[model samples]
Target: MVSDAVGAGEGAALRARAVGKTFAATEGARVVALDRVALDVGAGELVSLVGPSGCGKSTLLRLVAGLDLPTEGELWVGSELITGPSAERGVVFQDPSLFPWLTIRRNIESGLVARGVLRSQRHEVDEYLRLVGLEGFANSYPHQLSGGMAQRAALARALINHPRVLLLDEPLGALDQFTRMRMQDEILRMWQARGTTMLLVTHDIDEALYLSDRIAVMTPRPGRIDRILDVDLPRPRQRNDRRFLEHRARLLELLHLTGGIEEPLAPGV
Candidate 1:
């Protein structure tokens, strides 16, 4: 069973406290990218991280992924301290970084192979491929597929690992509107099917509201968690609902308060 720390069902899940990151420039100047930010991703939950440009959303994702260590604070995944990248946590970036020379099936299976799964377990790969709606594209190479298809393959690759948590860094950011909407549904379906804990970083507030149980709003440089907005909309939420619109307006108001919007403030009309 998945630990409660990660989901709603059982086991205490991942937690981070006072996390921060800083970088030193070649010019001998120090840059602070994140402040003492704290967050918790309960098991079986989809938490979307949304913020203005340069808010260090992606940086925070990387820190949670164990790609980099925080300059301060603590991060724990299922009682384990996050020191570096591990198979238990999987990440999908904006671009589908698949190997062009390898067939899609091989690409997805490669991770399993590295983890020492028996050759007989190769069939597990197809399940993920189908889960991502890429059943027919298995034999195709990365170059032969479109952006969305390649991303599907990437998703299959990540899921094949059966990681306890999935970190998505703007995975659907580059798709066209129609494609993006479709992919969002696909992702939600997969999340329901697997019950995997997910943290998605996105600039689109609408997308966040659509996919997340809660949305974490971050502040500009030296990023901090400014707010945590719970979405109480019932399952299968409709975009046109009055409550949904009200929530969106409230989020926009918060974003504006944090200087995320730059439009001229009009007099109450």
Candidate 2:
């Protein structure tokens, strides 16, 4: 039985007002990735974005992280408009793009080092290593670790900055089932411990249902919010529970409407 998942605290507030993005395609064509994508994330809340392929989930995340400017509208982190990347926000992509040349500790420390942390503050790096269950692997290089371990290092790198918000771009997509489930639990624990606001973009409905306070369903290309589902099932949710199955069905239905698999196989048979 899974224990109930708990919220960290009041999450930092974020708003995307009429945010939209367009890219110049080959041969003078233009591709609109997102349109009027407006959403709010409350302080300390874990909001998940789910959608069909080409739904611009990643684009929306980038907009919130301030890594890309919206073609129109604006994104705000609290009262300030986001202009560029800052230590205030951390991002974890699907690939655990750790530095192959650096030790796990060194890679995590690089974030602190970039902020000009003094030698005395280096203890912060070691603390985060332990936080991600990588205490013994500190000196190991990225290639020496397994996929899951590397991803944990990526997570450690993000958290060491003490970011107010963590943007996860399908960080667990590459992992197998067992590892993915374990990482899911670890992410929840970390969120509980840190109380930082998180926005996760994923293709997995079960993952969204298990982790998010609310799941935003999106349509295909030029993605816009299709519907928002408030997940009421208790945390540490049981994947096999009736309530969990019900939400999963609803999410699948919405995905179907967006031209995803018309019938997603039932949960684990």
Model 1: lDDT equals 0.83
Segments of candidate 1 deviating more than 4 angstroms: 1-12, 118-120, 261-269
lDDT of 1 by residue, 1-269 (tens): 11122223322257889998988855787778889999998987999988777778888989988999999999998889999997778899999999889999999987787788838679777677767777898899999998998888888888777778899999999899899988998888778777888999988888999899999888777789898999989868787889999989988988877767453432220
Instruction: Give the best candidate by lDDT.
Output: 2
Worst 10 residues of 2 by lDDT: 1-10
Candidate 2's C-alpha runs over 4 A off are 1-11, 118-120, 261-269
> Where is model 1 poorest over a 10-residue stretch in terms of lDDT?
1-10
For model 2, what is the alpha-carbon lDDT of residue 196? 86
Give the C-alpha miss distance for residue 268 in model 1, angstroms. 35
Cand. 2 TM to true fold? 0.92
